[model samples]
Target: MEIATPMATDDRARFETLLSRHRGIVLKIAASYAWHAEDRADLTQDIATQLWRAFPGYDPSRPFPTWMYRIALNVAIGHVRRHAPHSRLTVPFDEALHDTADDLTNDRDGLDRMRLLQRFISDQQPLDRALLLLYLEERSSREMSEVLGIGESNVTTKINRLKQRLRDYAAAAGHD
Candidate 1:
């Protein structure tokens, strides 16, 4: 093991601060990819470890979330690919059940739509899922391109296609 120097300590402090500030990105990505809470926690930890390993190459001038997202998405995609054979396309019930509704019948439509959307998302390929997540996050095309390492035009084209597919999915589910 290498000895910790003053510069290393400073870098550690900086990484901790940045990670804390953007911890939601990690959690969101993890939740999107992992079906269970334990898996999400493990994925989150894996992402944090990868981020720390890559921190030395991080450019302070660039936005941290973009860089963090690049690493996190890559990790999550890889995790999904590796576990594909064993992976179940299950959405966490908490995601759809978290919101309180006094009138259950009134909210049934909303909950149905949410479940349909979640199922559609979970059925998508890893890259498609990442694109959908970034799109839903309202990330700009340029930012999505940078994070996904695709061209801006490619990001736009993929977004259009995904939107159409989502529309079809919803229509087929009788949500419209």
Candidate 2:
């Protein structure tokens, strides 16, 4: 076993603080990729471990959330790819639907819409799913480009295409 130095202890404290502050990002990505609760937990752990390993190299000048998102998304994409044949993609939205609406009919409508949106997201390839998640989070095009390692123009184009696809899906589902 290795003894911790002062520098190492400081780094550990910093890492824990950062991770705690942005824990939701990890959980969101894991939920989007992992259909089962156990799988989500495992993916969250995997992401945290990878983040810790990469912490020493993290640039203090840049935004921490963006860096965290990049690592978390990569891990989630990898998890989905590795389990592709055995699992389906899912995201948790039940609470969102149940908590927002006051009327039963409105709740039903929200649930239907949520399910449609979820299906569209689940049907996407992992990279596209990541793009959609970033887009939904209101991340700027440049930031999305940085996280996805794509050009800003490409990010805009993909967002347009995704919007069109969602429209088409809604139309086909009689929600247009």
Candidate 3:
């Protein structure tokens, strides 16, 4: 059997592949939570930076996407906690998202609601955010639990609580 040799160039290439494949997921997840364009941009950059730092530790034996999610989500939650604009107040907009090439002009207020929901979701822990993202992605509970290393019942309970929290938050925010 031949032994494997670790190379920085190969590592960089693998990390870039990870970045390109998951940038959308990271940006969107960050976008939803950061809401404000500037904050979202910062958060996305933070995620990318974290990924770069964590890339060296990545295990070739493990599935890359799940590992990527863990790091990305952790960076996102840390960003919200460390650099979040105003905890108890809503940000007018996240400056970063509009920089993306999506045609969001038609549904302005709807985007606002999405921003609100993102902030609300950002309030949860990183693991919880991952779970919520998995749910919103229409992932099966088993898959979510597996991804987050939680029991199935735990996933169910958390998801229910998340929905209720969103409902209550929407009510509080004057959204129907």
Candidate 4:
């Protein structure tokens, strides 16, 4: 067995502190991607494990959330790809809405709006889902591009397209 040095212990403590502070990021990503509570829990655990494994390689000069988002998005996308076939991207919108509605205590109108948004997101492709998540999080275009491995112009273009799509969906759904 290897002995833990003081420096190693310090690093571990620092990592834990950062992880705790940023745990919401992991949770939100998991919840957006995983339909079931059990799947969300598993995804959260997987994200934590990946974050810890990647901590040694993390660059201090960069913003921590950006780095964390990159890893979390990658893990979430991978989980989707591995567990879900491309042809069956998600469960039916009504079923998903009912499942999620039971857990939300918001007003009926708010819940209905949220359910509509969720259905729109679920209908998107994986990359679009990631883009939408970052957009909703209000990440900068530069940050989004960095995390998504795409050009800034492409990010802007996609964001514009997604906004239009969402607007159209809302209008069609009589939420306009």
Using TM-score as the measure, the top candidate is 2
Tens-digit lDDT string for candidate 2 (1-176): 99999999999999999999999899788878887778888999999999999999999999999999999999999888788888575565454435644543456777688778877887888888999999989999999999999999999999999999999999999988
Best model per lDDT: 2
Off by over 4 Å in 4: 86-108
Worst window of 10 by summed lDDT in candidate 4: 86-95
CA error at residue 22 for candidate 2, angstroms = 0.7
Task: Tell me the TM-score of model 1.
Answer: 0.89
Ranking by TM-score: 2, 1, 4, 3
RMSD of each: 2.9, 2.6, 5.4, 3.2
Of 1 and 2, the candidate ahead on TM-score is 2
Residue pairs that clash (backbone atoms under 3 angstroms), model 4: none
Could you tell me which 10 consecutive residues in candidate 3 have the lowest summed lDDT? 88-97
lDDT of each: 0.85, 0.87, 0.71, 0.85
Query: Which runs in model 1 stand beyond 4 Å of their true positions?
Result: 1-3, 89-107
Which stretches in model 3 have alpha-carbon errors above 4 Å? 1-6, 84-129, 146-149, 164-176
TM-score of candidate 3 versus the correct structure, residues matched by position: 0.65
Candidate 3 residue-wise lDDT, 1-176, digit = tens: 66556686678787888789767778666765565566677778888888898887888787776677677766766665665456622233345445531655447787777777667765776567678787888877876766677899999999999889899989899886
